[model samples]
Target: MNMASDHAHDRPHEPPSSGRRRFCQACIGGAAAITVGTVVYPIVAFLKLPVRLGESKPVQIPLDRLIPGQAYYADFHGQQVVVVMSESGPRVFNASCTHLGCNVVWDTAHSNFHCPCHGAVFSGEGQVVSGPVSAPLLEIPFEVKEGNLIIS
Candidate 1:
C-alpha cells in the first residue's frame, strides 16, 4: 500500500459552480437597487415639500360686527375664504371646494354655499349637504374682538 493514499491531499478540489456565481450576482444587484431607491426617495420628498406646505398665515377677523345671515369674503394668508355664522358658532372655511379648487358661492335661497363647478354644497354648519364631495368644510381659527371677527 502506498503512503500517499492515506493523505487527505490526494482528493481534488473544485471551484464554485455557475449557479453559485449567479446567486451572488443577484444578491449584489438587489442590495444596490435598495441603496439607490433609499437615496432617491428623500430627494424627491424634499422637492415636493414646498407645494405641500401651503401659504399659512394667521389672520384676524371682526367676528362681532358680522351678522348671522351674512357671509363675508376676504383674503386670509393668501387663501380665499368665507366667514359665516352657524347655529353653533362663528365658522370660517376655505371657500375652495374639497373636490376641486373651484370657489364656492353663498346661495341665499338655500342658505348654503354651493360650488358652481361641481355642484358641491355645504350647509351653514360646514357640513356636506350633497354632491360628489365627501369631506366636511374646513373651519379656521377665529376670535371676537370689539365687535369684529378675527380669523387666524
Candidate 2:
C-alpha cells in the first residue's frame, strides 16, 4: 500500500549536524593542545637558563663586633661561611662538611665545628679533628680591610 514511503524511511540517516561536528573537533583540538603544552612547558623551562639578578658582593663584618671564642655565621655567594675568632687571629671557613655537604655547627662549649649528620668534628683552624671525614673544613680566604673582615 505504501512501498515508496517504506523505502524512504529505510534510507540511511543523515550525517550529524555541522555545529555538533565542529564542537567535537574543537574539543579534540583543545585536549591535544593541552597535552602538548603540558609536555613542552617543563622542557622549555628546564632548558632555559635562570637569570642571575644581582652580583655577588663581598661579605664584611666589623672586627670589633667579633668576640674571641664565639662564632660568626655569614652568607657568601649563597653559601654559608663561618668566622671564628681565636687568640691568634680571625679564621674563616666554609661551614659545609666535606663528607656529605652537611652544614657544620659551631660548638662554642667544645670550641670546634661539629657536623650533626655524620658526627664529624673540625678544629677552629679548619683542620679535621675526628669522625668519618678525611678532608678538613674548607678555609675561606679573607682580609682585614679598615678593621672590617672582608670575604670576597
Candidate 3:
C-alpha cells in the first residue's frame, strides 16, 4: 500500500485564496444582477400605468393648486400630460411633441409649447404654430368638476 499517497488523499482540500474567493463572489453577484434586470424591469414597467390608454379610466387631478395663466405637467396613466388655463377654460394636452415624439416644455413668455428637438412650436391649445410638425398635439379628454380635473 502507498501510505504517503493515502495520507495525502485523506487530507481536507485547502480553501481558495482571497483573490479567487473575491472573483467567485463577484461572478455570483453579476449573475444575480443580470437575472434580476432581465426579469424584473419589464415586469415592473408593465405593471405600472401605461402612457397610452386602450380602455379609458378616469383619473381625478385636483386643480386647487393650479394657477391661471400657468401650465402644469402631470402624469396621466403613467404618461406625461400638460394642462393649461386659458381664457376659455382649463385644457389638457399631450406632453409629447408632434415631431419625433420629443417632449415639449411650456414657454410662459411665448404663451406656447416649445419642443427642444427640431425647434417645433405649438400653441398652448396644442396647435402647431411653427417648425417641422404639420399637426398639433392630440388633446387628452378631461373634464373639470369641483376644483378637480377628471381625465380619461
Candidate 4:
C-alpha cells in the first residue's frame, strides 16, 4: 500500500464480465429509465391527459321535486341512477340490470324494477325478487344535503 495514494491492491480485481459490466449496464438502464420518464411525462401531460369536461365534485340532484310512489331518473357522472320515492322517503338504486347491462325501468303497476331485455325484476330497495338476476341492483353512495341529493 502506498502512503500518498488510496488503492485496493490487496483485494483481487472483479472480472469485467461479472462486476464492472453489470455495474455499467445497471447505470445505463437507470439513466435510460430516467430519461424516458422525463421525456414521456410532458407528452403525457400535454397529449395523453383527458380533457376537463366538468368538476370532480359530486352531482347534486333535487330530491324535493321527487313525487312519492314514483321513480325519478338522473344522470350521475355519466352513469344512470334512479331514485324511487317510496313511503319511507327516498330510495336510490342503480338503473342497470344485474343479469345484463340492460337499463331497468320502474314498474308502477307492479311496484318493482323491470328489465325488459331479460325480464328481470327487483324491488324498490334494489333487492332481486325474481330469477335470472341472482344479485340486487348496484347502489351508489349518496347523501341528502340541504334538501338536495348528492351522488358521488
Q: Please name the candidate that would achieve the greatest TM-score relative to the true structure.
A: 2
Q: Kindly list the per-residue Cα lDDT of model 2 for residues 1-152, writing each as its tens digit.
A: 59988986896755677686779989999999999999999999999988776648899999999999999999889899999999999999999999999899999998999999989999888889999999998889999989999999
Candidate 2 lDDT (Cα, 0 to 1): 0.92
Summarize candidate 3's per-residue lDDT along 43-146 as a digit string, tens digits. Answer: 99889976664435566778776777789887666678888888888888889887888889999988899999899999877898999999999888887889
Residue 115 shift from truth in candidate 3, angstroms:
0.2
Model 1, 70-145: lDDT tens digits are 7888887777889886666778888888888788898767789899998988987778999999997777777776
Compared with the true structure, what per-residue lDDT tens digits does model 4 show for residues 41-149? Answer: 9988888757777745676778779888788887776678898888888877878898987889998888889998989889888898985989999977688999998
Query: Model 2, 141: alpha-carbon shift in Å?
Result: 0.8
What TM-score would candidate 3 get against the native? 0.60
Better of 2 and 4 by lDDT: 2
For model 3, which pairs clash?
Answer: none
- Candidate 4, residue 19: the lDDT equals 77
Report the Cα lDDT for candidate 1. Answer: 0.79
Best by lDDT, which number?
2
Give all TM-scores, in the order shown: 0.57, 0.68, 0.60, 0.62
Q: Candidate 1, after superposition: displacement of residue 45 in Å?
A: 26
Instruction: Name the regions of candidate 4 deviating beyond 4 angstroms.
Output: 1-52, 55-57
Show model 3 residue runs off by greater than 4 Å. Answer: 1-58
